[model samples]
Target chain A: VDAGALDAARSRDASLTKPPGSLGQLEDLAIWYAGWRGERPKLEAPQILIFAGNHGVTAQGVSAFPPEVTAQMVANFNAGGAAINQLARCFGARIDVHPITLDRPTGDFTEGPAMTEAELLEALSLGWAAVDPAADLVIAGEMGIGNTTSAAALAAAMFGGNPRDWVGRGTGVDDEGLARKAAAVAAGLARHRGELLDPLEALRRLGGRELAAMAGAIAAARSHRIPVILDGFICTAAAAVLERIAPGALDHAIAGHQSEEPGHARLLGALGKRPVLTLGLRLGEGSGAAVALGVLKAAIACHSGMATFAEAGVADGPG
Target chain B: VDAGALDAARSRDASLTKPPGSLGQLEDLAIWYAGWRGERPKLEAPQILIFAGNHGVTAQGVSAFPPEVTAQMVANFNAGGAAINQLARCFGARIDVHPITLDRPTGDFTEGPAMTEAELLEALSLGWAAVDPAADLVIAGEMGIGNTTSAAALAAAMFGGNPRDWVGRGTGVDDEGLARKAAAVAAGLARHRGELLDPLEALRRLGGRELAAMAGAIAAARSHRIPVILDGFICTAAAAVLERIAPGALDHAIAGHQSEEPGHARLLGALGKRPVLTLGLRLGEGSGAAVALGVLKAAIACHSGMATFAEAGVADGPG
Candidate 1:
């Protein structure tokens, strides 16, 4: 964070016409944004990257939708017919859909590692290269039928929680499917025990290609000083790998929303990230982050647009 | 509200490409908005009315700022320099500021009634007339130095709560100012005990002109089928008067945000309102509601703009 820029923003916020600290979280958020975009920031180009890949764990009956739905959703995204497309339109953000080998599903983590080293590298490089350097903000989302199960396994392995605690009803799974998801998570952990010690190794072993790609995109965003809005459970779990590998790696990121998934709250708690919105959103594809994009815009609009008390000729109240 | 429109929106939501309830509160908010604007709604015209008044209760030292600051802020608003102005620009909303008798402050509620019946009616009429019938959405906000004290007294008189519970650090009041606010609230309730049995009488006795104006504007919005986004503590207290007199009078209104004021949560609970945003905002110039406008716009955009599963040629999951 740019300490000078943040201090300048704080001083400017106090000088605004309204009472000091009356805007609450918005004040802090604007300063945080200013830290990245300088004292006066404009959110002109926010990019939404949705990485889709097929999950082999869907064959274990761990999700409501079949694996083919991943590619179908990717096509839907490409056609600008998905929920994220509407949200992108709402924020005037550009949307990019990357389908990472939907024809070849990752190895079922319950049997072995989800991705080979080369496969993980390919997805990561694709995501790393996909970022637009000119974009002011980035939102990384994922689409995979059984990716939430993979997310739960990754979170449980990374944070040392019970598999059942990290599992949730992904894509409206029934009780049977929920149990199957938990079993799949536990099996994945058992199959890849010592190999999961390294966080990147954990991503290769337990996370799908789309998940690794999200991690890569988040890291790329950090490298470019583009603040990121982390999406739902799968997206956060992907970003969690980066945080585990290097502390403070996600300083440029903020959680978009606390999803309906139960593990989402636990993961956010572990990450010490308070989401910008909490409308019980669980639909991935960067929808929650896309929704929160308006909030960040509003915050910045108030910060840069509103006249200070001295300029407005308004009396400053004594605290 | 139009029941047919709401039902149509609900039906349309289920057919969208995402899971049935994956959108969560946004799905419900869009359906409610549809109830007011019909099944196909466009939120192009959102009008924000800010009512400013001077409160005599400031003589009791119940606020951080002097009462004269009300007129100064009103001038700031007129110059398009206030926080609400920036938010209005962000949403393309029009703002009309009405300063009611700022030269002649309302009578101190602790000493006597805040306004006579005629004075209350004048403020109410001004607010009712301020609403633009062509507007698709309305937001009512208030600006008064000691208005939170008036709001606390009104809430205490109407809802039978401890005055201390309703009193909060409005605009960064210190401990001494908070105590004075609570004492004033208790005195106002005691002085107008029998008169406040009627809700409108409570507004006349304990509420300031700005609060009554907000109540009037909210009622007018409801009459026009223009859904309202109620602001912080003072604004909600004003709307609460309508709900008290006529049960479900605020059916067209939704809370925009939970403010930093502690009483707001209790009042929202009593009114059966779940705020769309909880950013700890304490500014009373309709700023909270103005910030939440983006959230509503995003919801409506997703509801109306996203493609249905059949339209997108995507496979619908079992969910």
Candidate 2:
């Protein structure tokens, strides 16, 4: 964050026709943009990146949907026929679909490491290469069956909590499926308990390809000076890994929404991020991030377009 | 609320590519729109109506800003130089400013009724007349200096709460000013204790002309078949009075955002309304409502534009 830009944004907000701090979080959003971009931020040329990968953990019967649904949704995204595509179209953001293939399906982390270090690196590079430097804002989303289970496992491993506390129904699973998912997460944590303390090792052992790719995308976006808006639970869990591996990696990231997933709030809290929207959203095709772009743009418009008290000849409140 | 449209909306949501109830509150918003309009809702023509009035409550030294700021802001709104104007522009909504004048600034509510019954009716009619028949969605906002004091008094009078619990700083008031505002609310409630049980009487005695007009506009919008979006605390306070005066008047309304005012949550709760956005906003003048128009439109666009499961060849989830 740039101190000068933040100071300038605060000064601008105070001069707006409304009372100081009257705009509330909207004012803070503008200041965040200024600090992130080191200038008055414009939300032009925003892009959405959806990373898809098959989760080997799906073999554990953790999700209601089949693993093939990940590929099907990726194709759905490519055909402009998914929720993310529609949201991007509505919000005027370009959409990119990146499909990451591991050496094979991750080795079912309940029994062994989800992916080898080489495979995780390959997935990360794929996510990194997906970033478009010219974009002003980048939103990272994910599509993977059983990814929520993977996310929960990763969150538990990173934060050291009980698996049941972090597990939630993925794709509207039944009670039996939720129990299986929780059990799988606990098994995965136990299998990799030694390596789980290290964030990168946790990604290799307990995280899916898509989660790794999203963390890489976050790092790539930050390096490219493009602020990233993290999608729902799965995307945020990926960010949690990034933050652990690299301190302050999430400084350029914003939590788009509080997901309906039970662990999302705990994950976001650990990341020190406040979601821009909280509509109980849990769909993870970057839909939450895409919808939040409307708010970010409105905040930017107000920050840039609103007339000052002096300009409007409106009397200021008592100092 | 129309039962048939709501049923249709639910069916439509299920047919969409996403899982049932995947879009979270957005699904409810679409259903609300359908029920409000008695058909599929189209957000093509949205209009924001800002009702500004002066409050005699300012005479009690209950506000941070002077009473004239209300008129100044009305002028600012008219000049397209206010936050509401900028927001309306951002969301592509037509903005109308209606300034209401009382015979005097309704006698200080602490001393006497804010307005005579006849005057209150006239103000309501002014608000009613401001609603544009062509608008598909109507957002009602209020601008009145010291109005928060009036709002708190009205809320306490109708809901039987302590004035201290309802009163808050109107626009960055200091500790002394907050104390004064609470004292004024308590005084106003005492003066109107007998008549306050009747919601209409509460408005006449403790509400401002702007609030009366807002309630009128809400009733008018419902009759005209235009869905209404209620702004922050003051606006919701007006709707509370409307809901009490005419049962189901708020059936057509959506709470736009939770205001920072402490009394706002209780007021909306009393009306059985949940605000769509919660950004700690208290700028009023329908700014929160205008910003929310962006989210509403995106939801509408998604509801109307997204391809269905059959159309997109996406398999439905297991029931």
Candidate 3:
């Protein structure tokens, strides 16, 4: 972050026609964006990256949808027929689909590692290289059958909690399916116990390819000075690995919304992120973040476009 | 609201590509919009009306800014130089400014009734006539210095509460200013003791022209079948008059954001409204609601634009 730009933006925010700090969190958001971009920044291009990969845990009956739904959703995304596509178009964000070999599902973590070292590295690189260098803002989303179960297992491994605490009904599963999700998470934890100490190893053992890709995309956004908006539980869990490995790794990112998922609020608390919206959004594929982009745009628009009290001939002093 | 349109929209939402209830509150927002508009709704024209008035209570030192700032800011809004203008321009909303006799300040409620019946009726008619009947959505904002003090008093009169419970720092008031606000609210409550039972009487006795105008505009929106996004503290307090007079009078409206004003949360609880955004916005120019318009747009877009499962050739059954 540019300290000088941040200071400059703060000074400018106070001079706007409204009272100082009346805009609340928007003042901080605009200043933060100014720190990354220039003092008078504009959000011209925001990119939405949706990474899709099948999770082998679907075999464990951890999700309500079948594994092939991942590929079908990916095709739907490519054809501009998905929820994320509608959100992206609504917000004028460029949508990109990155499928990390959807035909080849990750290895079942309960039986073994979710991904081999080479496979994890390849997925990460794919995510890193997919980011648009000129984009001013980025949002990484995921589409994977049974991925929420994988996210719960990975979060429990990294953050340390009971499997049931992290598990949620993905795609509207029944009670029996929820129990299977918890059991699979517990088994994955037991299988990858020692390896969980290292965040990267834990991610490789329990997180899916799309999850790894989201982590990579978030890191890549930081390098490009593009502010990132973290989506729901699966996306946040993916990015959590980076924060665990290095403190302040996600300083460039903010949680987009607190989803209806049980573990999302806890994960956001651990990350020390206050979500921009709390609309009870639970769908993945970056829909929440895409929706939140409008807020960031409004913040920037007001910060940059509104005239100062001096310019507007408006009084700005206490009575 | 059209019941048939709402039911049809709900069924259509279930058949969308995403899982049921995955979009959370967004699904409900879209359905509500459809109920007001039709089975397929489009938010092409969102109208924002900003009513500005002066208050005699400024003599009591209840607010941080002077009364002249209201007219000055109203001019700024007219010149398209204020925060609300920026937001309206960003979201494609038509901005209308209604200065309800800004030259004549309302009588101080601490001494006597804020307005006579004729004055109250004139303000209400101005607000009622200001709303464009063709607008699909409407937002009412205000620019009245010392109006928060009036809001607190009116809220206390409508909903039983101590003066201190409803008072907050309006536009960054000092501790001394806050004390004056509470005292003013207490004085007004005592002065308007017996005649506060009727909601309209309470509004006339304690509320300013801008507040009464907001109430009128909200009531007018309901008659026109236009959905409304209620703004922050002062706006909500203004609209509460209608809701108090007739239960469910605010069914056409949803809170746009929870303001930083201390009384807003308590008022929202009484009204049974959950704000769409909780960004701590305390700016009363309908800026929060203008920003939330994007979220509403996204909800309607996803609800009306996404391909259904069978339409998109995607399987949709429990595993």
Candidate 4:
């Protein structure tokens, strides 16, 4: 973090017409932007990159939707017809859909590793290459039918938590499907217990192609000095992996919302990030992150637009 | 609430590309608008009315800022120099500054009633008249020094909570000022215990002129069929009063954010309203509500703009 920029933002916040710290987290948000940009924060040309892939875990019938739905949703996103599309339109954000592969799905983690080491590296490269240099802010979203099971498996293995504790009904699955999902996660963790010791190997073993891509995108965004906004559970799981692989990579990222998914809160807590919005969102087409763009815009606008106490001739409170 | 419009909205939400409850509170917010408008919700010509007044309780040193700061901030708001002004500009909402009385602060409620019954009624009328008929949405904000003490007093009297439990550091007051504020609240509650049984009497006794005006504006907006977005702690206190005096008056209103003020959550809870934003905001003057306008807009847009599964040729999940 840029200490000088953060100090400058704090000084500016104190000079604002309202009481110091009265804006609460907004003041911190503005300061965070300053620290990220190392100057006055400006939000312009924000981009939403949706990474879509198929999860082989769906063969276990753990998800409410079939794996084909992933491709269909990606098409919907490209056609400007999905939730993320509407949110992007509302926020004036540009959206990009990148399908890792249409024909091939990752191997079922319960049976074996989700992806070969080379495939994982290629997906990561694809993610790294997807960043738009002109973009001021980047939001990473994911689409995969059984991605939640893979995410749960990754989180369970990485965090060493019970699979049942991390597993949740993805896409409003029935109780039977939820049970199957949790069981699949437990099996995957047991099968990859030794491989999970290494974060990269764990990701290759349990994480999906979209997860790898998102993790790469996040690390790339940080390297490019562009802030990243993470979507819900699946996206945060990817972020957790990135954090383990690259310590402090999340300094450029923020969680968008607390999803209805059970593991989202734990993942965000592990990342040391607090979501700006909490509306029980569970859809994972980058909708939550896209929706949060409004708050970010408002915070930036207030930070840059409001007059100082001296400028407004308003009396400052006596602390 | 318009049941017909709400039903239509629910039907529309069901047809959207995502699951029925995937959008969570956003889906409910869109339905709220439909009910408010009795048709498709349109958020055009939004107006933010800021009611500024002074509290004689400031003489007791319950606030970090002096009473004069209220009028000064009002002038700053008129000059487009305050946080609310910046927020309004960002959200494309019109702002109106209404200064109740610069010279005459409300009576110290610890000693007596803040206003006479007639004065309270007049202040409410002023608030009601402040709403523009052309406004599609109304937001009420308050600017009053030491008003949190007054609000805490009202809430304590109405809800039977301990004064210390409801009092918090207003405007970043130190420990000493918080203690003084709490003591003053307890005293005011003790003095007006009998009068508090009647909600109107409670407002006249413990509420500031800005609070009365806000309550009036909220009631008037509902009457005018313009949904109201309430600001932080002080603003929601007025809504609580409105709810007591006129049952279901708050059905047309939604909380903007959960303020850092300790009593805000309790006040919002009493009204059965969940704030959309939780930025720890304690600043009054409708800053929270103005910032939240962006989210409301996005929710409305997504509710109306997203293509249904049928339209997008996307398959729905099997539950």
Candidate 5:
């Protein structure tokens, strides 16, 4: 359950062909889990869980667009105008979005946490029910407005580090706005110190219901032995909270990508995991998760299709 | 076609959507020929020609291995360990890989120019005859060792450009190797100047039979009104020579990708076209053209699936 044990398990596999370590990011991901669970790796069937909520912090004028765009974008996702839709078709993956607590029309994000226990429970229930027992992997992503602030608070409460280390200029914020956002995250945690003692309590104190639900979904995926692919900063923070309570929850976790957010690298460093893609992206809403799935697809094909040089009657590198 | 005229035909009413300018690369590719052909815009069943040949220039030690790698790689393509296999599967498009010469093991690139005149005639004959009447577009890609040198020779002789400017490092070559390659291309051209006079003859003199067949294939695709998608420097240069002989040859041209090759940009410029994907890549064997097909699939979906606002009951972007 400890980080040392996790690393030991990841290094357990040295029997794979081609080379001792040639698959790059994929080799680490597969090897990490193979050691933990003692099973040869495969990513044949993957599940994507999208957690949706409305942020209460939009009143700060931090976002270039309105919070209503979150719900509208979710509809666009379901209607299939989005880039992820095409990617899903290419990768042959199923997607389901869980709308928790907040919906449309402008609302105040700084008014403490608007998420209730019921909303959080409902979203978690949907995500849990969606995973088929026959599924091979699980991926978790988040969609919410001013959601970065909530994710920051969640990370602060999960890891005892400073809130400033977790808070970032999400979705392209200017320098002044980012500094103010960091200060806001610290304030939210300071105000909610009493309520956020446990992981669930931390979710109730600083995050939307969807973030709490995502925490539950990740925990469930970990227990079920399904590798959980984390999208970006928000999802990584959610995993941090899940890992705080469960300790070994990240055994099934794969850091899908490192976003352009300054906070993301700090969080990933704490997790001791490196991302596969480094495309300088900070956009959330599962877009990072969407593209990273392509790597999973390639890995799957390599695992399943590539003939060992011995089997193919080819020289091993060069004789 | 003038640049303004090309831009104008792309914006004509009854255009493919969003005034035909919203899809970026896809829109530019489809419109490049709209002005040349004086056609409002129609993309019929496309042809994707994959020409395969082994490079004789591999003897220079610029590559990690010897000339035999060229033949081994062609066999790998047929077997499918490469990236193009997956990209081709994504589109389910027609593909043809012509092996015009078997001189890789012998290391004689200028050896009677792979495909004799009769062979070139037959290869083109068989390539276009395979095109289905339902086809709407065409793409051409080549695989050959020392093919970049051949492409440069064809380009220099036809466009009368400096060979150094037209020579480029194929695959991943160092600066020292690049200089040596430039010299080899120049020497090969001087050794076979007479065959370099006629585009077809120049191809017969210094080019691989696969490159020559690719040129003829593009010419046939133009007559068939099938938009020919050029994979990289080799295919693009072959297309350039064809365009020089017949100015209207570009009527069906579609620049698939701008490769990392030193001369690909110059070739695209002379053809008066731009590529779709500009990722710094020069690996041959049809991978770029195959991946570029996904753009067409996306563009087709956008043109066909975009709701008119009347259909979706949502407001449209201000026209």
Candidate 6:
């Protein structure tokens, strides 16, 4: 989408009976939707897809925990131990976690996409088919150990940018862990022979199973005209690949928050996106986006419900 | 109220199901209430009060806008022009705006309470009379122009804090404006003699009418054993005056956020209260507290709702 559609959305936003630009990025996000859908954005209900998988890069001793933690954390998320779970409840958004082929070590760098090509498509089809299809908005979040390496490698291969520019500390890595992770990412990109084709194949080579599923979900979100929120670094990385396969795919993507990871901002900037808040957040697992989602939804509500000064008979400061 | 009680609240917090100390000041705020009510704190329909007034000290040219903007903004607050009004809807919190007193140059600052003594008592009585007996929490927020100075002076005279320590640049004033405001505050304190024998007497001297009403609401919130949230400089200033009249009143007070004001930290420290969030917010009119209220409620939910590793049957660390 060019600036024209965005402009159309803004005009719709301006007529929402609130102060001009007072609703901030929320009005902008909704306006973007208005142009895409050819109607004013209405925040009826939002859905979130949380993709869970183990990374193929942790074999390099990148993370403090093992791949088994991934399965356990999945249970925790479903049971509401994680921040994202609480956020979903708080914002009244429904979240469904989708598992993308979990397999044991090829070291912790488990080869992703355990399903065969045809089977992978079938699995993705089933998952998307399960969604009730009436959701007004969508967000994709990923949870897997050592996933940032997978994200960076996919980001580098997909964006045609320096692999080094795409690497950063994932969770709690110091300078040393970051350096090691970057080197591993470089090797993964080289291993793929720079061949970033079908997303599942990319997952099998340089990414993780969760990434492939998330990419499909992002594409689905775009096709559905629902604003898909990018959660933390890895979600954006997959978003980058999906955006390339289907140009203008990112038009539906909203960068939720800036990550503490060095490369996350670069990824966001490369995609021409801006984050809603910067709280020095380093925790991933959709925490950043989950918090940001509340803001987005609140902004939408502000745009939709607030009475214009004219309607309220209050004077606005002169332009 | 005492070290022992505060310690008990802190100890109860560490035992909650979520990550240790993860709920932030919400954990502390809850604990503070445990001391107040001698039980765990749950935010069951918390109520917030916002009072509106203008300052006698404003004639010194300390603010970026005219004092009349105070009343204008109060009307805006009631009609939902500022962020706080939207936040009130977001959190399902109730708010009251009292147009109490102003610095209109013609009103006699020395003759009477910001409101009549009877009016001050009636507002306090009204606050006392309004709370739901079954409510689990309460919060007080004040919206007064140039009221930060009065709060500081009130703090200095009654709370036994230094004048410089209690004063702060409010609503984004320049250095020169802040200096003049500080001087006027000192003069006001000298003129009034800080007589706080009655809450109304305090109002007549140094308190904005809205500030005094806020102080009454704070007293009511404490007496009810419902947590009262102090937003930035103005609310905290009013809280200090209320506490001076009722020394045990700090029992349920919770500083909502660490504001950008120079004296906010000092005021919070004097109360032995730590703010739930440090967002550098200095804008008054209950916006800071209102924004923090959602997160605080989330924190309560986290503490009360999350399952432990043992209950969830998830591995805590490396197995």
- Best candidate according to lDDT: 3
If the candidates were sorted by their lDDT against the true structure, best first, what order would they fall in? 3, 1, 4, 2, 6, 5
Q: Per-model TM-score of chain A alone?
A: 0.99, 0.96, 0.99, 0.97, 0.84, 0.85
B25-75, model 3: which lDDT tens digit per residue? 999999999999998789989999999999988899988788889999998
lDDT of 6 by residue, A188-260 (tens): 6665563556655665466666766677777776666667677778888877876666667687778877777
Q: Which ranges in model 2 have alpha carbons more than 4 Å from their true place? A: A102-104, B38-40, B102-104
Worst 10 residues of 4 chain A by lDDT: A310-319
Clashes of each: 0, 0, 0, 0, 19, 3
Q: Which parts of model 6 have CA positions greater than 4 angstroms off?
A: A1-42, A76-83, A103-133, A152-204, A240-252, A258-285, A315-319, B1-41, B54-86, B101-133, B143-207, B240-284
In model 3, the clashing pairs are none
Error of 4 at A173 (Å): 1.1
| Residue B303 in model 6: lDDT | 48
How do all models score by TM-score?
0.99, 0.96, 0.99, 0.96, 0.65, 0.71
Candidate 6, position B102, lDDT: 43
**Superposition error at A295 for model 1 (Å):** 0.9
**Candidate 3: deviation at residue A266, Å?**
1.3
What residue pairs clash in candidate 2, if any at all?
none
C-alpha lDDT of candidate 5 relative to the true structure: 0.61
Worst 10 residues of 5 chain A by lDDT: A13-22
Worst 10 residues of 4 chain B by lDDT: B35-44
**lDDT tens per residue, model 5, B1-319:** 5566566654442232121232334344445555544444444344556666665555554443345545655565577654455445545666555555655322344333534577556655655554544566666666655677667766787777677898765644568777777776677666676666777776655566666667766776666655666788887777676777778667666776677777888878877886765545566666566556655454443333343334433322211
Per-candidate Cα lDDT values, in order, are 0.91, 0.84, 0.92, 0.86, 0.61, 0.64
- Model 6 residue A217 CA deviation (Å) reads 2.2
Worst 10 residues of 2 chain B by lDDT: B310-319
Instruction: TM-score for candidate 1, please give it.
Output: 0.99
